[model samples]
Target: MDDARPPRARHRPGAERWFRPPDEERRGPAGTRPPWLSTLLVTAVVLIGSGFAGRNQPQRVPLDHVGYALLCAGGVLLLFRHRFPRTVTCGTAAMTAGYLAAGYPYGPVFAITALGVFAGIVGGHRRVAWAALGGLWLSHLVLAHWLYAWLPPAHDHAAPWGQELIVTAWAVAVVAVSELVRVRREQLAKVRAERAAAARRRADEERLRIARELHDVLAHSISVINVQAGVGLALLDDDPEQARTALTTIKAASKEALGEVRHVLDTLRAPGDAPRSPAPGLDRLPELTEQAKGAGLAVDVTTEGGHTALPPGTDLAAFRIVQEALTNIVRHSGSRTARVLLRYGPRSLEIGVDDDGPATTGQGEPAGGGNGLVGMRERAAALGGTVEAGPRADGGFRVRARIPLAAPPGRATGTDTVTPDATEEES
Candidate 1:
């Protein structure tokens, strides 16, 4: 037996509208329908349906067919709006206002009207949209109460005040939703800009870290080898006994440099799996001076006050300050002797390195490109420390640095020496 439902309630055999996909749904952009065309189509559907219902009504306003014609034209113009939003919105608003004045009497054409205004809010300048909305409100009030006095009843007169309140509330609702969408778009743009800036900062910092590590590893090892090579070449004709000791220093320095490079590479590859042994810290100052002495520079070290444990970053900064200073001496100073002083205090630690090298003067200053000083300053600044380098008043060149005893993460330790607890601190 056939189902005993009403024919309208049943899925009728010939009602094809439900089964056929909308042209917009079938052929539009993946997620969004073209705004102008979508607005036009929606208005057309409302207009045509309303026109059929009102066909037999008397035409109280002028040029009834002309009003319908303008609406149809306006709707068609709206279809291209997304490609040209401002122009389409302006045209639609002008035409729709005219239709309302001509007594088209609020058909489904209002849907297209609302969409055009929303498009203006979304795509046009805030001032323009505000001006347009204000003008629309004035027009609506004039038409409903003044020009069409005998036509439809005014909103506040015929309907209860609550009805007027409902219409006003809905207008506010529309504007609120549109503003929310605008704010979200701006926020997304801001987030993207911040992300791009952060990426650039990380790239620059990584490059600097790599350069500093290379400097530390190569400068010490190379300086040692250079010193030993000089000794070996000189002793070739003289005392071969001392020459053997120089060669051993060269071999040991090379091996240590290689190990340091490997350590840095491993840390870069998997920081979590990096060896427990840390980078050289401030406590290694004695060793650094001895290494320089082995390279033929007589160095003196002085430490003042009972040594307090330094923060890891601060310790590293202290070490780098000393290292860079010694490296600078190796490169520029023509002197054979240097002094390193480490002063520890309650709040901070100070390091100073000076050499009695020949004063750099005459033909255009020593041309070592001044980057050693820059690297030293950068190291100190990273740990909230400050560095000063210049010619000493006592006819020598000095590199001095001050590093904070402690700092938060992501801050510079003012040294390459990253210290942690007591274990790594000793090394």
Candidate 2:
């Protein structure tokens, strides 16, 4: 049941190439037909059409045949209007003037000539086109007068003047439409190019931001592993049992770091990959509070209003804000007690983290010089939210973030929490 057929030859040996010259060696003589033969074909059509229209004119001139020939040739050159507008226009103008002066039948033939001249002028120059229009009208006026006088029946001379005005207006209309099309095309191209460039710039910035995040995540975790390993090595010679415990902590930390690294790498490898794991959210504050406690920081968690699950971005922002705030406490706060309060309200969620540690006593010495606060602010700002951090009035540092609970733009929620922690004026 084979239905396949043999392929046929695409070309004949002796015939000219369908679209190209047969003589591969003969690059035609200079000024001969161009590689784009279509241009030549179009020129032939324009010339022949205009020529036949002109040849049929019943006009009596001493060199009527010569005028007709020149008109046909000029029409052919006019086909190059877009390519060499000025040259074609000037040549066509000369030929048309010659045809009119040779006493062609004025009405129908003059109309065709006027159209050709109009094309040339629009393609050439606006001022020149208008000037040519005026000149042609004057010529027609004079010719009409001659015809009126020569004909047996009297003809109205005013009639020809009105006709001249109408033709001139048509020429002006053509010029306006052509210029409008050209201008619109240029504007469209510019807008498209600008938009494309802007998109590319945004993509590059996103990539750079991702790179920075990956570096931050790796550096922080790896640094912790390094410090723990060093401590374990030092203790190994003195207290083997304690060293083993530190080694176990190191193993756990390294494994967690490897998972985070793999998640980041996989995201980079396949852009369409799903979320690695749900990002930490406000509901996980208890776990975070415990982690801080484990790291030897005393923390108190307070809730005000009944809490509800939040939008993913808002939840993530709240969690990170608290995490960074706690990290700062451990790193900078020499205090034994820190407090985290989550306040959920009708419009927004307010998070406040504070530590009653005495301020570090130096300029440019971050009580914990770092980007923790900066990270918190950035996360909030991305969600049309805001955050503030400064030393508390009484004594200590405080960090607060406000995240809107309103679902981001196009989402709906039916069963979300209604209230947040309501603690005020704590001692």
Candidate 3:
């Protein structure tokens, strides 16, 4: 079947430029028209007032067909004041001037015009609103003079200057009210944006902290498991007793790791609940050395100077730093013997971990790719502390950290003092 219509042409690039949909069209679906309906209601009120004023006048100006038409036209223009505020303001002002000049009775037309001007200013057409107000004021002055000079004075008693003053005051009030509303809306929007940004930042920080906690718990436990597994495998046939001991070490390490991981998870799941176990601190150094010995590493602990109690956060950070350092020594440094030194000063605590082992690589990275050193630095820096880690001149790795002893704000220093037991070797 042959059709009379021509074949459709293919669309070219930028073809939509000529037929782009308007913003209103893209939004789709019209909502309720309550605002426009309210404007129509206001216009009706003005029309009724005008009619009533014209009928009740003792010396009526006798509005003819044209005068009545102008009065109605001015009120009608106000129906669209919100949608086209500037245009409605000008149109209503012109119609009101015509009605007044035609010797029509003064009515509610001026009220409608004021509403239009207010809408224009609130709609962000301030210049147009000001211009309309000035034009209306000037028109009122000229019209008042013409009425007094040409027509016999009726019941009008107000002076022209006084009338103009009242109208000017009304216009100024409208402008001030609109500007206050605009500023208040802007301030509310700014506050909402700032609150949202703060929430996002806090969320990011919490996620990072959780990631660091998981890494610290898992890395140390997994390294011990790896070493014990190797020992168990090597002695499985030749020495069952030693293999069993190695397996026991592995079991204990895995159990402790599981407990720590569960604790972290519980804290995340029920943040309002009290923690099931207290966080490990420097007091648990002996237990940590025992675990390291089980992983086939020898550790020596030494202490010097006064041991003052630390803030909870600082204490936790110090313990994590040492744990991460030792985990690195076990997994990366091929050292059998490691040394830990703790020094307490008047205003700071110094911690040192040195191992007589070959560096994993020339760049001083641990065996497995990890962020242990970066985590150490972050922990120290959070408490106004510093850390240094690198290869030593004696062909081994050394990690040194200095944490300030300043108490946290609003907290008193603990009265309890910890005295470190001199050199203790674990193998």
Candidate 4:
């Protein structure tokens, strides 16, 4: 038994008009709502307006069944303008030209053709719209001037040369309007795309910033806590007093780490609120040295030149760079001592940390693809500066950063540099 309903339609390659799948509706037309409503409105205007126009143009053909059918066809073609703009444009132009060739009175019927051309141009089918509309205009020119004498409803003489100029002006107006709308639509689309791209870039930068801040805060504090915990465990079995001191250091380090982490994370919870505390700066050098001492690493901080206050960004970056460098020394260096040199230049600040060493017995190099070194370099670079790290030919490791200060710090004055054991170096 042969069972069949209507035959299933086979979609031909490159034939857009023959297929309308489910996805076509979900995707919308060119990422916008379809123009079906406008098409229907224009179709109504064409039929109603041409009936009136037919009464005024007695020499032209009246609105008969054929004329109405051609006008409706011109409007129907526009329904697919957004999806297949070039196709709709050619189809509408052909239908309009046929209606004109039959000498049907011209009115809003031309609007259907113009709308198709507009959609084609705006949908990025520029050359096709231009070619179709031009062909339609030239076809009208020929029929009105040369063929009207024999083709229409009775004695219609040749149209005047001046009337041809009006037709030329009308065609120019249609093209100009279409071109302007196309350009404006593209500009709006470009602006929207740029805003979306900018938003994505900002989100990426924010995530990176948060990551860097958390790593800096936790790495130094956690390293100090790790060493203190080890010391406490080793001492608890023998020296109760030393074990108590190690526990105290661990508590302080843990408390400080929690505070800094909270500060960094608070920005995510309440972005517009003022910080709970001021960001750490180089003025806190004494605290850093004391923390290093807890981890059995001595840090000598020597300041040269004017020690004037720095911009908030520069100050915070300098403090973090030094903090991370000393933390690395504590974690990776066998050396028990480190030196931190802070030199204040007229327009920039230079920071250096060095430790005399061979690589810690079995521990490898520290700066190989480590986030600590990368974070230091990134901090310096953000301030329009540079960071250099390597083994000093004199038999030690060195990390130095030079950060430009846009606002020049004031003149140098005599001051004392703080040493690890509370000793002072006069500047």
Which sections of candidate 3 miss by over 4 Å? Answer: 1-159, 361-369, 407-427
Q: Give the top-scoring candidate (TM-score).
A: 4
TM-score of each: 0.70, 0.63, 0.70, 0.85
Candidate lDDT values, in order: 0.64, 0.56, 0.71, 0.77
Taking the tens digit of each residue's C-alpha lDDT, what string does model 1 give over 205-261? 655666677776787678779978899889966988788888888888888889888
Task: Mark the regions of model 2 whose C-alpha exceeds 4 Å error after superposition.
Answer: 1-41, 60-159, 208-216, 219-223, 226-234, 283-299, 330-337, 357-372, 393-395, 407-427
TM-score between candidate 3 and the true structure: 0.70
Query: Of 3 and 4, which scores higher on TM-score?
Result: 4
Query: Sorted on lDDT, highest at the top, how do the candidates line up?
Result: 4, 3, 1, 2
The C-alpha stretches of model 1 lying farther than 4 A from their native spots are 1-83, 98-111, 146-172, 237-244, 270-277, 359-368, 408-427
Model 4 clash number: 0
- Per-residue accuracy of model 2 over 1-427 as CA lDDT, tens digit each: 0111222335433422332222311232333332235435544554455456555643434234665576557656645544454555556555665566555433333333444444444343656655655565565566555654553223333344567667667656756654554455445446546766655654553454354345445544454455567768888999998778767766765676577667656666665556567654777777666555544567898988978878776776677677767766655666767899998898888999988877543211334334455556656655656787777766688888887777556323211221111221111
Instruction: Give all candidate RMSDs, comma-separated.
Output: 13.5, 12.2, 14.1, 12.5
Native-vs-model 2 lDDT? Answer: 0.56
